[model samples]
Target chain A: MNILNGSAYPNNGVHLNKRHRKAKLFSMLCSLVTWLGVALLGVLLYQVSSDGFKWLDLQFLTSFPSRFPYKAGIKSALVGTLWLISMVAFIAIPIGVATALYLEELSGQGRMNRLIELNISNLAGVPSIVYGIIGLAVFVRGLALERSLVAGALTMSLLILPVIIIASREAIKSVPMSIRHAAFALGATRLQTARDHVLPASYSGILTGVILALSRAIGETAPLIMIGALTYVAFLPEGPMDSFTALPIQIYNWVSRPQQEFHQLAAGGIIVLLAVLLMMNTIAIVIRYKTERKYK
Target chain B: MTMGTFRLVKKDCINNRGTRWGESLIHCGLALCTLISIVTTFVIIAILAKESFGFFEEVSPVEFYFGTRWVPLLEPSSYGVLPLVWGTLSVTFGAALIAIPIGLASAIYLSEYASHRVRSIVKPLLELLAGIPTVVYGYFALTFITPLLKTVLPEIQVFNALSGAIVVGIMVLPMIATLSDNALRSVPDTLRQGAYALGATSYEVTTQVVVPAGLSGVMASFLLAISRAIGETMAVTLAVGATPNMSFTLLESIQTMTAYIVQISLGDTPAGGIAYQTLFAVAGFLFLITLLLNVLSQWFLNRYREVYD
Candidate 1:
């Protein structure tokens, strides 16, 4: 008021102050909403632990799922989740990294390159269930994979490939151009420059993306469900071709049942699922932070 | 020494040729790996198209698009997809209604008001929320949300759309918050400063200057969030139930396009059978809807992206 209208607006100052206070209150309300979100997460955790902690034991993790909730263990589902994640990482990482390298290093900002870039981003947003339908049609049926662990993994790999590729491309793009030039000055070819200079510099970032993608793959239920991951598996999958039930599917199955005990089991399964998810995410975030500091 | 040096030079030359050969081999392998992603898009489209063609041949387009009922398994199977589409619409609309305001409010707070220390603590928690599996959210919807709603609404069904929509809204909250935060943060500080110089309050500057500037990005985020809510399967499948009712009331149990796919796929529908083929047609519709939404969001993001020099 002093700067704009000098003493002329002095009488209006009270109104302006009132408006400012209202705005401040509104802003504070917004901040509270954000905290409300955090509080929701806390409540969810509290609920899960209260319902689930009693049943969460070594036997719960080791034994095969049983008809009785007390006897049921997540051994097969746990093992199946591990096997599925490994398979997804096996298929997604190298391909995602290579695609990132191709986009960041080899391709220019030509029309085709831009189209591919756009396609990758859009693919990232495609609903997980659509990927499930595709998996059902292609891998499970067309490829005759017979709803095996391999089929589930392939579907998940496809579902997460875009996330990994996008993250890797960002990592590769962040590597300084002078590093590649330094390698080239030593009589290195483009491939040699990328391999010796860029790839090493960006590998940590790439690893973070791969780990994050795998974390997501592990939590995914729809794509695996679409691929016909068995809802009830008494035995562990012997190989990639064998039928498997993952933790998420098991949780969903148990929740869908009418029994109160199964609901408790579902809560326990959520705890395990969330613990693994948070662990992987923490690892990814740590790697990302470390790499960021190193670069800085 | 000269004779030995000459031998070393000749050996180096041979090794260079071998390295070149190895490089080409590795290059081809990497390129093939990259090709898999491009091939995946085509394969999805082709498979959906082929099976969808079979479905359309059996069920007329008029009936498929305009028909109100969606009972594919029952006798005199009515393949009208309107019910499924409407189910999706109501669920998505409910989710958007829940997610957009809270998500945008939090985004504004994070971008404009949060201290750096508070931000670092909160951002990761949001990521953790995002990292939660949909299945777990499904379980929560069934076990927590539905029962909680029963206390408030007394006569709510066990598998109503309200709980499903609420959980789906929660699932999408992180996306909207993160994206809108990015959008708000990308607004130039100079604009806020200019407003402040004119004695505008922080709220005035944020809502008037920053939000308007970031409008397109925020709009894009809304579209992305809606698309996600629409495609969410397990939570809806579990909480919303598989009854394909065309009611607009959020309290009713409704089946979405995705829930239908899950319901059918969970059971053994034989290959080339009507039930199996019907899923592909639904998948094709879902694919088109999501692809269109994604492309539209991308377009908004690209076209109206505020570029600062």
Candidate 2:
């Protein structure tokens, strides 16, 4: 309040101050709520490290899971996740990007494209576990893929397709129309314009989106669980056709065990899982930084 | 025109003609890739329909939908799915109870109060929290949260819906916070300035002006987060018991639809049996519920969104 206005309206000072005080207090409460999330993360990190740090060793990385917690490791799960994600990447990226290109550059604003857009958004909202239901029915049962690594890969590809497509479409959309117009003016077809000019310009953005989405796929357990990936495995997956387990699956298996030591192993597995996720995210962030700076 | 220019133009037309045919074919192929998502949806519907058709043929739809008990593994199994539905709803409700206020408050702080430096650090860190695997959340719930709850609330079971709710709430917090933050931020600065010029306090501007403007987005986030909580599997499966108890008590063990499906997959439940069919049926219901919520959320976001350029 202005000093002259406050003097003219005597009680206004106390009332205005009260309102300001309430606003300050409310802002503080909001800040506290924000920090609550950080507190949760801190406590969780502390909990996992304290319980499982001793078990996170070289042997833990290399050895196969055993009935005994002392010998149990995430070896099979690690390799299996590697196999799954590689196939997922190999299968999903091209198809997803192609879909994004079709929708963003070619389809334009047609009714069909709108339907597809709406469908993808709906698909993105479908729970990961429901995708597992399809994976179970179509791949595991119908195709008789029998929980193979490739089966898991295909399932995950379908699950993440909507996300990848959405992200890539956003990336493609960010490539302004002027670039495409320039190419077209130079006698290039729409395809040529998109491929030679737009795609290259948006590559980093698409890569970041892909990495972030794949990182999400890494942490997903429900669909893999729904497809009946084998939890108990002594050996690693030999090939795409072999049965496989993943990081989340192994963590789930260990967690469900009644033993306290198994929970600890689960924590160890989580640390590894989170490390992989963050590593990918870090790559995405670095690429984003490089791209942002380049554009600037 | 000169013969040289005419010949060059002719060659260009031929090249364009050749590439145009190839381009259309490439376009169709890319279009097929886009159609794959639609195909996935149809395939999901078809598989659930074909498998669940048998179950519906055997058990009356009314009984399956309205029945309270859900004992698929045991002989003389009651096929009532209300228990599972109740379980899913109760956990989702409980999770919303924990997530909404905290999420809304955090979103306000993020969009309104936080400095750019704080946001730069906190936002990505919040995403990291969201990125954590559900299985790990399950483990945390089992190893940490349930035990901690037990210290004060001794009556709580080792595997109870309460802890399941807490973990699910944590799991979805980032989505609510991030989406609502975007919503609030999208409410243009002019509105806040107008309120401030009218002598409204910052809190009044935020709670009254900014929040009302972004209500649709906040509501959409809530819907999506609730849907996610319903569909969450490993955490609920691990944190909550497998007992399909119809009682809605948070302290007691109950099984969600997701947890029930996981239970079937884990057990030696004979494939192609009624029990297995029940998995499809339950999953079908889950698909519908989440699908409806997703569509509604999308509709709300598109319909009511204030596009301030």
Best by lDDT: 2
Interface RMSD of 2: 6.4
Please provide, for model 2 over B1-309, each residue's C-alpha lDDT reduced to its tens digit, 9 standing for 90 to 100: 134323333433344446477776776677678768878888888888888889999999999999987877777878999999998888899899999999999999999999999999999989889888888889889999999999999999999999999999988998899999999999999988977776777888888789989989999999999989988988999999898887757999999999999888887666788888998999899999999999999889989988787
Kindly list the per-residue Cα lDDT of model 2 for residues A162-259, writing each as its tens digit.
Answer: 98999999989888778888899999988888899989989989999999889888989989988888898888778889998888899988888899
Candidate 1 residues A237-287, lDDT tens each? 899899999999989888899998998998998899999988888888788
Query: How high is the lDDT of residue B190 in model 2?
Result: 90
Task: Show the lowest summed lDDT stretch of 10 residues, model 1 chain B.
Answer: B1-10
DockQ score for candidate 1: 0.48
Q: Which sections of candidate 2 miss by over 4 Å?
A: A1-14, A293-296, B1-19
